[model samples]
Target: MDLSTVTATLASKSYDKVADICDNLMLQVATDGIGYHDDWPYAIHLLSHFYVNDINSARFLWKSIPSSIKENKPEVTAVWRIGQKLWLRDYAGVHEAIRGFDWSQELQGFVAAFSELYTKEMFQLLLSAYSTISIADAALFLGMNEDDATSYVQQQGWTVDSASRMLTVKKQPVVTEQKLDPSKLQRLTEYVFHLEH
Candidate 1:
């Protein structure tokens, strides 16, 4: 069967069904005798299994990857590392591990493909998010009354206050208008006239 068929069957199958298929495919592709002509399809199939959380199937595919082709196949390695880091709860490490690597050059352009899905705001949110910036704390930092913290949190986005080590990163942008406030403008003019005297 083709790679798509294998993927569909594996995805539709129960965990046990997938495990069995993976076991057979592993044997067929892991052998040194078959060239890429025979092995690439199975490799793609094995990697797809991981999409459904079949870590073992993914592990088999990873182990079967030839060292000789690792450089040329940076994407396979990059995808595997991305999965590994995510599975290991190394969120920060995931960014660092893939930072220097161009996703366009890696496996199926995984990062390049997914980067557009994340908005600029979402990316900034990830960058600003940390253990210290809890929603409640951010509201208070925004000059919100104690009782209004919850409301502010729901309505406004806040960042972690790095200096105070509190969730006080939320700042309201000061609104300015081309026409100055009439009262303030008059007061400023009077002050300037007094200074001239």
Candidate 2:
């Protein structure tokens, strides 16, 4: 597989295609060894997974990479650590891990791709920790503007008190279903059994 073509696809935001190519390339590497090339392809494969928010896949790829290669490329190791912290929702740790480091173009792209999703996760974490918080504070925590924060709260059906500048998060309603009629249950069971057989 041509790594440059894969990189171009990624740069064009063709994430699904990038994923497919990365999978095929990794399979080739596994079955046919690295050939005459180095392990940079593995790094690209990990980045593709990360770009699509497939943290588990990225972690699996990271583990599959040889420890010697990871040690030689500090950037790959750093990316792995950042990915781990991101998966664990350790926002502070993630920030600390990447601080003062000059990221490569590929690493920068991965971070940029995940930025919005990471902000959303951070917002969820903040909301879980605080039932009621000022909109400004929430916006700061979420790395969003005040208007965006208000819109986000509204989207979740949470109440925002403009006068108090506070957001009130009502618990989501639990949906309970009425018991099925005996005849309906019997019909469903028969249908399922017929499909299984």
Q: Against the true structure, whose lDDT is highest?
A: 2
Clashing pairs in 2: none
* lDDT of each candidate versus the true structure: 0.49, 0.72
Model 2, 1-197: lDDT tens digits are 45777778768867656766878776776587666235456655665676666888888878778778887887777777778877987665665655535778775765566555566777677657878889987776665679987898788877899999999875666689998899999999999999999
By summed lDDT, the worst window of 10 consecutive residues in model 2 runs over: 35-44
Q: State the number of backbone clashes in model 2.
A: 0
- Candidate 2 ranges with C-alpha deviation above 4 Å: 95-100, 121-131, 134-197
RMSD to truth, every model: 18.8, 6.4
Q: Write the per-residue lDDT of candidate 1 for residues 1-197, one digit (tens) a residue.
A: 22454555534533334445655655665474544533354333434454445667577666776775555666557667755754674544444545546644213433432322222323345336543465444332333343454454434564444455444444546687778789999999999999999
Predicted candidate 1, C-alpha RMSD = 18.8
Best by TM-score: 2
Task: Indicate the worst ten consecutive residues by lDDT in candidate 1.
Answer: 112-121
